[model samples]
Target: MNKFLFGLLLTSCSALGGNSQYVNPFIGTSNFGATHPGAQYPNALASVSPFNVAHGGEQNKFEKDAAWNSRVYIHENRYLTGFSHLNLSGVGCPDAGVLLLMPTTGPLELDAREYGSSYSNEQASPGYYSAQLNKYAVKAEVTSSLRTGLSRFTFPAGQSNVLLNLGLGLTNETGASLKWVSEQEVEGSRMLGTFCYHDEDVRPVFFVARFSKAPKTFGVWKKMPRYQNVEADWIGYNDSIKPYPGYRQLLSGDDIGAWLSFDTREQEAIEVKLGISFVSMENARENLDTEQPGFEFDKLRIEAQKAWDALLDRVEVEGSDEQKTLFYTALYHSLIHPNILQDANGDYPLMGQQGVGNSKQNRYTVYSLWDTHRNVHPLLSLLYPELQADMVRSAVAMAKESGWLPKWELYGMETQVMVGDPATAMIADSYLRGIRDFDVNAAYGAMVRAAEQREHNLLRPENPDYLTLGYVPVDDEGPYDGSVATSLEYYLADFNLAQLALALGKQEDHDKYLARALNYRTLFDADTGMLRPKNRKGEWLTPFDPELGRNFEPAPGYIEGNAWNYRFYVPHDTPGLIQLLGGPEAFLRQLDATFDTGNFDMGNEPDITYPFLYNYLEGQSWRTSRRVRELIAAHFGNHPGGLPGNDDTGTMSTWLAFSMLGIYPVSPGMMDYALFRPSFSKVKIHLSAEYYPGKQFVIENPVGDLDSDKPEAFTLNGRSIDKPFVTHEDIIKGGVLKVK
Candidate 1:
């Protein structure tokens, strides 16, 4: 590639104006937001993200090996070791950040510390990212298709080399195999799991990387582990990297890398396209050939940009530049996960099994269900019903293959990262919203099995205690405690299951599960006015503090939250809880105190709905609008530190997108949404003709003053509704909502 072609390509991309143009991929890259400014298509299987977490300890105060880091790129980090493909975004735990490719111009250096460079001039958008490596004076730019990543490096006149490091990543698991297929191609597989450090859950990712031109020299290297065996001297590299110059064979070890060196003219460009798949090596090769066929980097970039614009265009907004950037970026982050898992030939890894499965439709993976089921899935059902239906079908397939629905599924394996039967709620919520293209009967059966099976139940390990005692006591036998929080999650899951059961005409199951849903009353101690932890003898856990779990500190019986956070968690039976807390007045006072005293955490999902609970109280719906607006103003922006915290696989982003759109699906499996003021003057939700009856849904704020601290009352379609909530039917029916 030459300068003229590159300049023309940049001009062509700059000429196009779409909603994707407002998207700042760097918005959530800081503040522990866990999002990466990577080059990826919407719901893509592959992404190219800058890998800087390898060394940033003293300068940035954070490094992967020094602490529990979940992302590959940190905004403050200047060191650049490589660019990683197939990375996870906005997740709390680490996995799948592997297959690093680094370009350098110098002598061959296998050690990342010795070869890494300091980067500058970083820029990123929807489908593009570029940075200048100061150490090597090489410009690196990356773009991606659905399953393949393409990287172009402009090298100076000298010997240039590209190295693929397989040993370093966010995942602790090692062992990788690489083969120099030819002068222009290399293929291999890397073991990538032990997610959140759980040993049993593991899978292999296969990929084939092809270079645009044949290299001057290429070889594979291995870093042997320290061992005192007889063959140690024969291998010759103990606890050090051994490079095999010009070798064209297969090599397997704990830590290994392969490099391709080339003699290039000044400002010459070389491109590498990598295709990845979880199914097989052949599928990976097919994905590369089908997605790229030729080294047309600009064509792939434009296609990816268009693909993102199509999705972002679904909701058009009228707002300040900052607000539009925040909204679209949040939407962008929300769609990255639950990505396509099938290869070009529709082959995918079977869930929790040793076989290949086929799905002509998309087989989705990376389900952060415990986080996403809260708002992300519901948002998907409303905006992208077809994709949501495929996700539901994918859930059913996982249950069929693994004997249970996934809690936190990644690459066909369940890591069980968080508690709760969240899949039930997500399935029920989607089904209730008319996204029923999936096999509901099979899903319902799986739900029943998970709820009833006690002997070897993976989802509900404390099910026997809950069934026998009406609540999971703090002393019950389980993998981890947090009994009160765990029980609350189960009750919510049971409520959702009950709704689905009633919809399916299983009156008996509905009655049983609905009763179980209200079992939270057992843990609700009238003395503390909060749900306190109780032991098997029906005694409250002694020496308890309501604020024990603030800032992720350990609490006696809570998971990631405290008593104040879980106080109003009973969304299904809020009226009952209000009565239990004495009356509406007392409940309002307690809830207000929770916010006014700084107890309401906007960063975590456990209490994200607390702000909207004000709508449940009569004449106090104004508080919902006011508090939500305050949160938006304080937390979200159009910069790297914009997001509140770790996106939890877009859970927080979904909250922002829904909150800004003026309607939030506060409770999953419930049709009613808590209404608030729209952030923009007008928002147009383009409905799908195949799934929704109306062509569009409009939300208009005539006054359109976002900075004004006034609480705007909402009127649906011109009629003044007294309640602060609107049903899903009314929203999808397609009419204008006036925020007066």
Candidate 2:
């Protein structure tokens, strides 16, 4: 065995103690969460998810909506076309559900409409999936390694075939190329980009597929235009499009595919293994050879399960079966993105550049930083310090290659989606928590460059105005909105930068950024007790309504939410927020009114920490525990539609995970965790000793009444604490947290 394979086996063996059997991979597959019950190892490069929505016929009725265009939508149950090899989970936008593979019997059919089948007896777990194709009488089972996907298909007697569909995918970007290496192997590449309609940074993903048995007959298929008459064909006029089959070694077009036909007996099984890479087809094959060298289906499936078990075992919990399912599933979802982006040989595509770059460690991608910076990175720093550090290194490397930090990066390309300089906050938070293995100096330099420079297509589009006027101005007459929201995000980013600057002993930068971090105060309107829009003339915009932007409607000064939700988003300075709202009694009254008047949006990130703000108050902190429990019970479950909203690349799940663990990081780039009442009686966290000083951190609620409205007293390591918070240093040092 190779050294990399040996290391992976050792890692998987060490993590075998966790109960991965409790993980329900289908938890957030419905209710618009956009999660897929795919077979994937934790933080792996590829996932084999069922592509059911695109099948024609009765399934088309339920799949007509725009939401069905997502990576995988499980609500529609009429047909099963194939299993897509690369898919995104719990994301709002569509990207990278390509490289589809399907099995069939009888005459070979290339069209998805003709080859689709109805499926039943479906089952899924972490790193494994299985389904019975009723129409073809084929049983399909799949498992995965970090960079490869393995599938075993059982077919009945008669002519059997396996099809590789390159044209049909979840992405809006089209065009692909495929080449056959031999009867049993093929290589291909597909274009992927246009995330949320931003199409400037398109890139190609390459893959290699190998079948266990060589096909008796193999050929390629394409959906080409059909000519009507001889005269019309001479004039290049076409009547319709049809699938044309041929024995071609190479094919390239917007719609093309390949098929392999095999003769098999009853209950005969064929296994296909596929490897994917963003760099080259050679790397793809190498990844497959190194990670999964053989067609050992059951053995690989068991290893995948053990891989997940080791990851979930990091946080062992004592709870009911239902709670355990949700917790482990959330943890599972949290580790899917920021996935390993480099090939096994450490070769990765340089962001915004043409050539491939090499790194010593895994170069991670899919950083939904605007959402994940709030909680996901903090959770990783606490439990998986080495992985978190590698992610930080990935960000720093992106900045070096692309000349700007990534906002919503995917597969080595910046999508420029969402607002905020959140990568800075995430890196700063990790560094403060002792995840400093990355180039801290270079990271700090990147943060400073993003904060000071106003570059095009970067996060700080309104940086000039922000620097000159202390905030981004509302362009009511023009196309721009979200001035208030953007400014507040910048303020948080600046706060995190200031903290990092202070830690690095750069006093001048510390003073400059610390002053800029208060820019959110300039947008606050004392008369309305909420943030409002300001024009270039430094005056509040006329006719403001705090509740105007509800349910994702565009308001004059907000993005995806209203002033009520964004008002308390000053997590870095809650005391200042309370002071702005008046005294403690008035602040509590207004906060209570927000919940009573139905202004709370649990599905969004800005208001996620709103319920936890009560912990900052001394005697009234019990309200946080009460509200957290209520939200979890109302929104989260073990069913298909379990999550309240899009997982935002596991940000929502991380929030639930931290809440159930009885602690939350109120602010990134800070060490303190806001305490809450944990759902379980006992919780144990296995900390990585490479970065943390402790082996384990335990939380015990001996009362066992998770429904308790308030926590009366708290102690850490047998010492009494009057405050409702604990530092990262405190937890990493190892101790028992007892709440009463």
Candidate 3:
């Protein structure tokens, strides 16, 4: 089909159907967004993403090894390696971008550099992606179920081959084992981890790839290690791809792959489906059989699209085509992580342990707590409370099995990627927002243990000093050594924990954590109006520059950002922070300075709530609305580079989604949302019947007030709401919020 006809067909299909049609999956695929236009189901364990980072072509600006490339596919990169299954999306670190499946014609090429081709005619939606390989005139399309990935490749009449390259991946770790289970099946386990370059936190991911038709011939190959000694002369296959034609047994090596060759008629289409699990190979195959029993590509594609539509339908909006596309795409990215981890039979790898565990409900992975704790979990609590409840259960289960809450968990393993005890805040926030189906007592106990366990505390190494000095001392050496930043994170976590304690009627614990939560005040410098680094002697560090850590450069007491970015980061106690900053007027001035001086980083999490801070000052809420609208206009759009930076596993996207919806959960543990003017004429949010009292909540802008950033006033359910904010309770008793 021509581009114009294809566009018309897509428009017709979208008009006839669901919200998934509004999603542009490729929006965050560029400008370091770390999101790929992959075929992913909402919160699915498996995804099929085009792998293009391994080989560098003239069209490619970034390669896997050239820089800190954390994604499997880049929007600008035209070179295509294969479709990698079991991929991680919107992450800043590399892991799980493995199990490459590619098709080539004429001759079998095991090397990715040789088999890789430039691709064109790329297209993607919520649950599907397709592209035409320019080199071989072949078309590749992909879709997925909950735990399985499916791909269809159309080849020209010739000798065609499908290769499953186990060696090439974005993971830092190495070594894999591949075996031919049958003529039409291949099973393998690839070592994946060292996330963010940590060596000891590695684990194997098992997968089973099944083909639609048996190959004419198949073989497993290994790239033998090159020898430097005299034996090099005799080793012909050393450093070269060694093929074992028809060898069906198992082979283990750092660089190995399997290829299946066959002669095809004109435009012959072959399907490959993959099932993956963290527990075992049998479970992987079982997941495949249970989720995908047949090779009906279009049927599965429609089913996957419907699955996405169900999730996307939660928020319906009326807007322009571009506006709707950006809104739905952001919503799409936000729902992609903390995915289902358990296999078909409810079995998953025990958290940081050496055994299999079973969950009656869904077990979730990819915590990315430091990022998702801010907005993603809270968003889920409102829109999909049952899923949020399972996620809370997953966190508590992790504490039971691993003895500590996950910091940046992946595949049930603690990478300890980011700082602070974010899981405490996540669970407490979920529970405070009325998601209380999990064991709150056990969760609180875990929080207290991580808070008080000074020795060998995995979550908080700065705990001992924090307990004594009321803040993390700048003297400590390690990842958690960001005294001001780490201390700020702990304060937020402690504040959330205190709220949970108060809700559970533990006054003593509440008082204790509440006091500890105020420790952020100890790091505040009245002179600079920013949190400054302090040592054990209660002395501020010399030569303080609030902008020292800008652009992710290291400062004395900050991580990922400067002190100015974190100045207004005290979300739990904005009043206290405002008082410390000299008052509401001074706070507003400093906050304005942060934005006016180019110090506000919309990409990072520390400063995400700054725009919403204007809601705290009386009648200054218009500033919040204006800043949010301007930020969205400047940083987001309906293109590959729409996102400002890394989605941080949907943190940035969730921020955008919430901003577009005219509400901001300024603090996680808080039940209230700071309101603003939405970007749409009408937005209807379908509430979960199991968790919410009302059926739906709608925000209406009847006068087309979207052109203006700020609203004069607001009325909920036909009654005036004095302040530009609403509680979780108010929203769940759902009705329309009309902008006047």
Candidate 4:
């Protein structure tokens, strides 16, 4: 691309307001154990991928399989599995990509993991997703939104045909059932639910898929072949594979070979309108009318682009073209989840309940706390308070409708994914900091239940061990043997819950949960002074090496990291955690030791929260300045791998955004921000009126000690302040923090 053309494109995108011309939605759309080839549009209510027998799974997943290169049936999971009407972005799990629809001929295998062809990066994009199916010599192009999708497939003129293979599953093969409801409308679908992380996090969702296509000859078939569309439109074999009024097609294969047909005139165009609802097919149709009434391809695309533009303009960055793409793309991904849960008339299906109704507060899904807690949700509390309040409320509602608060929520189902009762911290931190729109009592109830729930992702209980020992024991029988990482997370959650209980005025609950918070002491190895794992026999386990980062899967003992990563995890009671680390000087020394010893793996979440822990430590104020800058430099850039760890959806980027704006959530449940040097010279934060109008955390880089070249100095409005952190309330309620 030439400079003039680039400038023209920039100007055009600017006219569109926020959608970036530089944004290559295809960036993370490929690698990183993800089948992110871009199909299910952001915030869409359906599994809306275009027709094709490819697309493996989430972003960057196929690098492992030997047949990966040849596999065209991309069994997408953790994302809108080829636009099947539902998905969770950025999670490392598999679910909801069932019912493969291929406009093909010949034999089709109900399971797509076979024969699914590999795709190239050059084909996928934000408003468009494309790939070639080697089997049929056909090219599939898909564009989508929460409600509608436009699929255009080009095949050989003479043998033109398309088939809607209704037997495929997103990630799970069995739970998905589809049947035809009416000649035009079909519904009924189930994904038995998904196991998020191990077994602790599970998402049980039932959807009614409504297709705009006319019901033609329909039966349940799995491994059938290809065909094309004869009609200008096609009913997308809505997931009613159960019975009459249901699109249920239980196949033993050979019965449904992608449900065939073809057009003698327009082999060039075949449009598919897919509407999905956890509520019902009626609601799904209602959603389609609400979002895309006519389903005109170009108009919907323009509208989607316009919607994206409005969001992108929230924060404008001045940078190179590539940098702008990476930055804005990150921003785009950040706003995606906690999606618009309420239907057209503002109704939503409550979590843990089968019914649907109006949301008391706005409901959103996709909770990536284990990764996002560090910065993402906090960012929402700061920028989009209303939405944040809605999210907090939704989490609260889940507590009411469901038995416990959600860990990894998709729709209203809690896929007990990841570790920790993170929503505890998220809601507490939000409300305490003044995002009070969510139900306080309900929030408390959810927090309490989360703390009490014994079953975790590992499918083990917090039962005897968590209550008696204060952590997931290394001696547990499951895949997640009790180790340091799980224990540390449990302690932090307990501490956060304690704070929430106190704020809500539940004195007894406060004391109880707070005591649990201090349980980290049980895991603290006083002799070595590092928070380590304790064996079942009441003895501290030796071989305390931080660098190895064991205990997580693929590794095992730790969670998804090692000892060095897990050691600094006591954010809620950092002062207490500090004492366990020996003392302030020892703690800071250990923190510094982390930096110098090359164990500071900024790429992971277990470590990002560490830089902010200094605020709780008395003398370590200065190190935060140096470390935050270094991590930002190392992790964020104009490239794809710029994310350190999983990026855990927007969690990783939230760290960058917050750090750049000059603060860190030392204690999330509390609004206090540990001060850090600003990345940009000046950042005028967009704060909420509730958080004190006209008061934004502003930074002016007079000295610009970005490289840590100058000796650090701290001050408040020209006077040197003794402390390193400022309460978010202090910033909001109007106070001057001048640091130099």
- How high a TM-score does candidate 3 get? 0.97
Query: Candidate 3, residues 1-740: lDDT per residue as tens digits?
Result: 24233333334434328888877777778888989888988899999999988775676768644456689988888898899988888899888889989999988888778889998877777678888998889999998988999999999998999999999888888899989989999998999998888776889999999999888989999987656556546543346778999998889999899999989989999999999999899999999999999998888888888887888899899887777777887888888999999999999999988999998899999999899999999999999898899999999999999998899998888997778999999999998888888888889899999899888999997889888888888885554358888899999999998999999999998999999998888888888888888888999988888887786777788888898888888999998899999999998898899999999999899999999999889888888889988999899977778899999999999999999899989897889899888888899999999988999999988646676654458899889989888999989989989877
For the record, the alpha-carbon RMSD of candidate 3 to the native fold, in angstroms, is 2.4
Ranking by TM-score: 3, 1, 2, 4
lDDT of 2 by residue, 1-740 (tens): 23233223323423344567667777777777888887988899988988877856666555665344674646556577888898898888888888999999998778788899888766777788888998899999898989999999999999999999988888879999998888788999999999888878698899999999988898887777764567545546443324444455678988888889989989999999999999999999999999888889888888888888778889989887677777887888999998999999999999988899999898999999989999999999998888898999999999989888889999999898888889989988888999888888888878888888865637688888888999989964233348888888899999999998888898898889989988788988999999889999989988888988876877888878888988898889899989998978888988988888888888888889988888877787789989889999888987777899898999889989999899999899778899888888999999897888898999999755778774558899999888999999999999899888
Clashes of each: 0, 1, 0, 104
Model 2's alpha-carbon lDDT is 0.85
Model 1, 1-740: lDDT tens digits are 23233233332444368888777788778898989987989999999999888864464457644368898888877788999998998998877789999999978899887788888767777888898999999999999998999999999999999999998888868889989888999999999999988898988899999999999999999886656556546443357778998888789987899999999999999999999999888899999999999999888888988998889999999987667877988999999989999999999999988999999999999999888999999999899998899999999999999999999999899898888899999999999998888899999999998888877789998888888998888884343468988889999999999999999999999999999999999999898899999999999988889998877877878888888988888888888999999998999999999998888989998889988888889878778878888999898877677889998888888999999988888788799999877788899999988988988989888754654556557788789988888888887888888777
lDDT of each: 0.87, 0.85, 0.87, 0.57
Better of 3 and 4 by TM-score: 3
**What's the CA error at residue 337 for candidate 4, in Å?**
2.6
**Against the hidden reference, what TM-scores do the models get?**
0.96, 0.95, 0.97, 0.79
Q: Once superposed on the true structure, which residue ranges of model 3 sit more than 4 Å away at CA?
A: 1-16, 64-67, 228-238, 478-480, 709-711
Query: Runs in model 2 with CA error above 4 Å?
Result: 1-17, 66-68, 227-246, 455-457, 476-481
Q: Residue 168 of candidate 4: its Cα lDDT?
A: 45
Better of 2 and 4 by lDDT: 2
